[model samples]
Target chain A: MSLETPLHRVEGLGSSHSGVSHFWRERVSGAALIPLGIWFAVSILGLAGGHYVSVLTFFSRPLNGILMAAFVVISLYHLVLGLQMVIDDYVHSPGGKVVLMLAARAFALACGALSLYALLEIARVF
Target chain B: MADNPQRPGHRPRPLSPHLMHYRPTPTMISSITHRITGVGLGLGMAVLAWWLFAAARGPEPFALFLSLAITPLGQVILFGFAWALSYHLLAGIRHLVWDLGYGFDPRSANRWSLVIFTLSFLAPAGLFVLAYTGNGGYYL
Candidate 1:
């Protein structure tokens, strides 16, 4: 009385034949962002209106450098993944979706790389 | 009524239901805001990238970026970015909780939505007050 093939039943995959990797990754990143985001906000807010030396000195701190680099990488990755989901949801045309997805992904990667480079440069880690 | 030149056996794609017909609810608003804030944050990343690059570039570029960032229009943009960040963080937590199979009930979901909506505004405002009242004008 069932229509599903044996392979399908055994695989237990959805219509897209994919597991919950997307959902899991999004949630994991989201959770990580909470603490990291708070720290970032505090650091930046404190540095606001400060002199150039102050800003550089802040990043020169090893802990701040490490946290900032981590925050940048994770947040950009999360941003791209979330944008991918949103574009997939709303964009009707396959071509349009592909364009948006690639743009977002490339933007995220470029930003992430640039940010980490800046952090390393500030820390004088080369 | 079939056109002679039209392609045969093509099927129209299914569409998502229209949005206007449904009553607006907190859950719906939260869902929409989630997407909006995600976009806002995505856009804000450009500013962050620029700030970092300027810092790496040295004093003059950093000064340029800092001056632009402190202008009134820049402050407004920063406030909006901060609010978006706060809202997204709270809502993201709510989502993570839901993903764990809790808060699906109408009441809890609505409660979380309302809480997030209020705190998103208050958090940034509180930080502004704290920053300005402390020593120098550092309220971001």
Candidate 2:
């Protein structure tokens, strides 16, 4: 009997922590990744055919290690956020949506952890 | 909705345009590609972590990584990642620009999308060349 539109009924419902903070985070993380990602890509190209020692040397450098770790963390953060949006779009079931969302978060966290760990271990000589 | 009793035959309301309903444009394609690449790069993150894992494990494992990377399939994956990253970066920057309230015109939007697509392929190809052949054969 309610005249309220569906959007009116659901507005600020269903995981509304606040206004578009999820969106804002995506943009901020994405913006940061532009520089970090570019640096990582070009550096990898520099090492492209390089010997094992050269890679090891690359890892050993303080700046390279720091930047690689930063890039990995931010990239994964951006990725999971993007995945969340995609899942929200296509997944209709509430349970399925939550499952997919959790899976995305787990995937990103694992990847980031391993990346950071590897960066640390590879640069152990420093 | 199909279940709504107010409808005589219980038919669903006509939905908005689905994929097949409308003519596709550069803007549309670019948008879908951006999302696809975004997910694709999620998978790429695993590869990135795997690479760092290999690198951290020392020379033997690192050599294994290099060997695999030099394979044809591995090259394809690497090149795909390169292109994906490039496209996503450009598209992401475009989003940022749009957020700032620029480039909303259809002509400029379409043009930027084409430019993004073009650079995505070109940058990766160029980088791949520079990496494999440009600097005296691959790596050190």
TM-score of the A chain in candidate 2: the value is 0.83
Best by DockQ: 2
- Residue range B39-136, candidate 1, lDDT tens digits: 99988988998898898988899889978887899888988998999999999988888878999999989988999999999988877776667633
Which regions of candidate 2 deviate over 4 angstroms? A1-15, B1-13, B136-140
Native A-B contacts reproduced, model 1? 0.53
Q: Residues A1-126, candidate 2, lDDT per residue (tens digit)?
A: 977678856675444645578989999999999899898788888788757777777877898888888888888888888988899889888999999999999999999989888888877753
- Model 1 sits at an interface RMSD, in angstroms, of 2.9
Candidate with maximal TM-score: 2
Candidate 2 C-alpha lDDT tens digits along B7-121 = 6777666666677788999999999999999999999989888888887887787788788889999999999999999999999999999999999999999999999999999
Chain A TM-score across all models, in listed order:
0.89, 0.83
Going through the candidates in order, what is the number of backbone clashes in each? 0, 5
Q: What tens-digit string does per-residue lDDT give for candidate 1 at A1-126? A: 988899998988867777677877888888999999999888877876657877788888899889998888899989988998889888988999989998998899888888888998998932
Q: Where does candidate 1 stray beyond 4 Å? A: A1-12, B1-17, B135-140
